[model samples]
Target: MADAAPRLLELAEHALSTPFPLRLRAWDGSEAGPSGAPVLVVRGRRALRRLMWRPGELGLARAWVAGDLDVDGDLYEALDLLSGLFWERGADGSGAGRAETLRDLAAMLRDPATYRLLRSGLALAGPGLPPPPPHEEARRRTGIAHTRRRDKAAVAHHYDVGNDFYELVLGPSMVYSCALWPEPGTTLEQAQYAKLDLVCRKLGLREGRRLLDVGCGWGSMVLHAAEHYGVQATGITLSVEQAAYARKRIADAGLADRIEIRVQDYRDVRDGPYDAISSIGMAEHVGSDRYLEYARTLHALLKPGGRLLNHQIGRRPVRDEQAYRIDEFIDRYVFPDGELAPIGATVSRLEEAGFEVRDVEALREHYARTLRAWVGNLEDRWDDAAAVTTEGRARVWRLYMAASAVSFERNRIGVNQVLAVRAEAGGGSGMPATRSAWLS
Candidate 1:
C-alpha cells in the first residue's frame, strides 16, 4: 500500500498533463499535478472504478453525480482547465501505447492499494459500469423521442423539476431564455425585461392583437406581452408544472383575461389566426425531422401578415475534430431529445413553409451572458437550489449551464431569433420598411 500513492500520482501525471495548472487528489490522500492549484478531488476508489469502466465524459459525469468526484475552487474554472487537457488529448490521436499500458499495470500490481483498486475496477461487469441510480439517470428520457407523448415526458423531466428551483435560478424576472443586454453591467432582471420588450417590438405587438407564446416557460413572455403590449396572450407548454405556475402568475397579476396558460403542445393549438406568435427558447425541441412541420404549423396558426418569432439555439457545423469528439452530454443529462439545427436549416424551413424571413438575429453572446447570470444565481443560492432538488440534480444544472456558456462563447453553438412573417394573399408582409422602428 505504501507504493500505491506514488503509482497513482504517476498515472495522473502522465494521463492528465494539462497546459494550465490542475491538482488531482486521490481518495488515499495522494496528490498529483501542480501543488496548491485547483483540486480535482477523487472522493473514493469508486470514482476510479467508475471512470475505468465507463470512460470519457459519461464516466466522469456519473462519478460526479454519484458524489464520488468533486472539485475544490471555482467550478467553472476547474471545468475549463480539465477541458483543455481533454481537448489536447483528443487532438493527439496517439493514446497510451502497449508499453506504457504494461508499465502502468506493473506499477499497480506492485502496490497493494493500487492493485486492490485495479482489481475492484476490473471486476465490474462488461461494457460499462451499472447505470447511475434512477435519480441520476432521470434525464435519460424514455419512449420515442420528439413524439407528443415522449416530448411531454422530456419537457416534464426538465421543466417540472420544480418551479421554486427554477425561480431561484431564474430570479424574480423568471425569463429562461437569452436576455438582450442593451448595455453592459445590466442586471438579469433588467436584461430579461429588455429582451421581452425587444421581442414585443420585433413582433409589432399592440393592443387588440392576439399573441401566442409557444413553449412559454412559466408565462414570462405571456405576462410581459399582456401587461406591456396590451396583447391578448396565450402561452402553451407540455409541462403541467409550468402551466400551473404560469396560471397562478397570470391570476395574481389580475391579467387572467388577458393571458392564458395551457398545458398543451404547440401542434395541438388549433385556436389559430393569432396576430403574432413568439416561440421563445422552444424551437430546439422541434427535432430536425419536424422542423418543416413546426414552421408550417406556426404559419397556419398566424393570420396573413402576422409575424412569428422562432427563438432557438443553433450550432455551427463543427469543423474541429477535437470538439466534434465530445458527444452530447447535455442530451444525456439535461435537455433530453433537444436538438439544435443550423441557422440556415431553420431559415430554409421557414421559407419552404411560406414564411418571408424578415429578421435573423444571433444572440450568441447574450445567451452566454444569460447562462452565466443563471449560474451565478444558482451558486449564490446553492443551499436553496439543492434543497429543492437532490444535490445530484443541482450538480447537473451547474455543470450543464457552465459548459453551455463556454460552448456559446466559443461559437460552438448560437441562439438565434428568426423573425418571419406570413405574407398576405397579395404578398404583403406588413413589415416596417426599416429596422429603425423596432430598435426604438
Candidate 2:
C-alpha cells in the first residue's frame, strides 16, 4: 500500500505536467486519499490498475466507464483539457513526443470488461453493426448505384427512421446539429436557440422572403425561421419519412401557410432564386467529387447577393492520403454513404464556383458535448430505443456513440459551419463590416 501511494503520486504528477493537468481520485483510502481533484479508484491493484500504470492516452476514458473515475467539474471541460494537453505540443520541442507517449498510455488502459460488453451488445444488434467495407469497396458500390438512388439511399438510411426515435433523443425543437455555444456560460438549450437564431440572422431572412432549407430534417429550422423571422420557408429532403413528418409538424404548428416540406433531391430542386439557403448537417452527403456541382447548384438557386450557410462535418489536415480512410464502422452502421471532406477542399470548391467565404467557425468541442448528450439520452431510453429498432440497432447506436465520443475526444473529426455569400460579377459590394455583429 505504501509503495502504491508513491507510484500513484508519480503517475498523477506526470499527467499534471503534461498540457492536460489530470487529477486522480480513489474510492477507498488505499492510495493516500484524494488530492482535491477528480478521483478514479479501482477495487484493487490487480483489476484495471495495469491500464492506469501510466496516464496512457485512453486511460481516463476507460477509468470513467469502469466506475473507477469520477469528475468533480464538467465532463466536456475535462475532455477539452485533455485535448489541449495533446495540442499544446509544437514542432520545435519535446512536447509533441510526450503527447504521443500519453496517447500510447491511453491505449494500454482499455478495460477488457467494458470492451467485451460493448462488443457483445453490438453483435446482437443487426446488420447495421457490420464492419465498414474498405474505402475502395464503398466507393465502387456507390458508383454502381445511380446518382439519384445513391443520394436518396444515403439520406434515407440515416434519417428515414421513425420521428419518435429522434424526438426521444433530441430536444423538443429536434435540432440535431451542434448547438452554438456563443458565450462562455451558455446552457445547451440557450445555445441551441442561439444557433437557430444565428442561422436566421446570417441568412438575413425577412418577411415574405423565400428561404430554402436543403436537406431539411423534420423542419425544425424551417418552423423556427418562419415563426420567429416571418420568412416563407420551403424545405427539401430526400427522405420521404422526414418530409412526411415535417409536413405534419408544419401543419400542427399552424405554419402550413408559411412553410412547406418537399421530398426531392437537391439536384432536382429548381424552385427559384431563393432569398437565402441553409444546409445544416446535409453537406456531408455531398461527396468530394460532387462538391463543385453542389456549389454551382447553390449559386444558381440563390438570388443575386444571397447568402448561404453550410454546416457539416469536416476532416482535419492529413499529412498523406493514408491518413484518410472511409471509416467502415461509421459507414456500415451510422451514416451509410456519407463522406467528410476537408474544410479547405469545400472552401476551394465554393470559391471556384463564385461564392465568397464569409465566416468559418469550428464547433469541435461543442459537437462532442452534443454527442455526449445524445449518448446519455439513448442510454436513458435504452429500453424504448431497443423496442423501436430492436436490440441490434440499439447496440449499433451504442457502438456509434462510444466510437464517436472517442473520435471527437481525440480530434479525429470536426464540425465547421461556414457562411458564404454569392457575389455577382461586375457588381460593386463591400463585405459585411462585422460578422460578430450578427450575434448581437
lDDT of 2 at 402: 52
TM-score of each: 0.86, 0.68
Candidate 1 backbone clash number:
0
The superposed Cα distance between candidate 2 and the true structure at residue 18, in angstroms, equals 21
**What are the runs in model 2 whose C-alpha is more than 4 Å off?**
1-142, 182-188, 425-431, 438-440
Clashes per prediction? 0, 10
For candidate 1, give the lDDT of residue 54. 61
Q: What are the runs in model 1 whose C-alpha is more than 4 Å off?
A: 1-21, 35-37, 85-131, 139-143, 319-328
Error of 2 at 417 (Å): 1.5
Q: What are the clashing pairs of model 2?
A: 25-39, 25-40, 56-105, 56-106, 57-105, 57-106, 58-106, 125-392, 126-392, 132-328
lDDT of each: 0.80, 0.68
Tens-digit per-residue lDDT, 1-440, candidate 2: 33443345454444345422445433335444335433334444422342434244333333333334444544444555554555444222233445554445334247564345334323322233222222211233436432888877767666766777777677576887888776778766787788889889888788899899998888989999999999999999888888888999999999999998998888998888998899999888887778899999998998778889999888766555433455544665567777887789888998898888888888888887777777788879988977775555555555466556666767777888888888766752244568766544
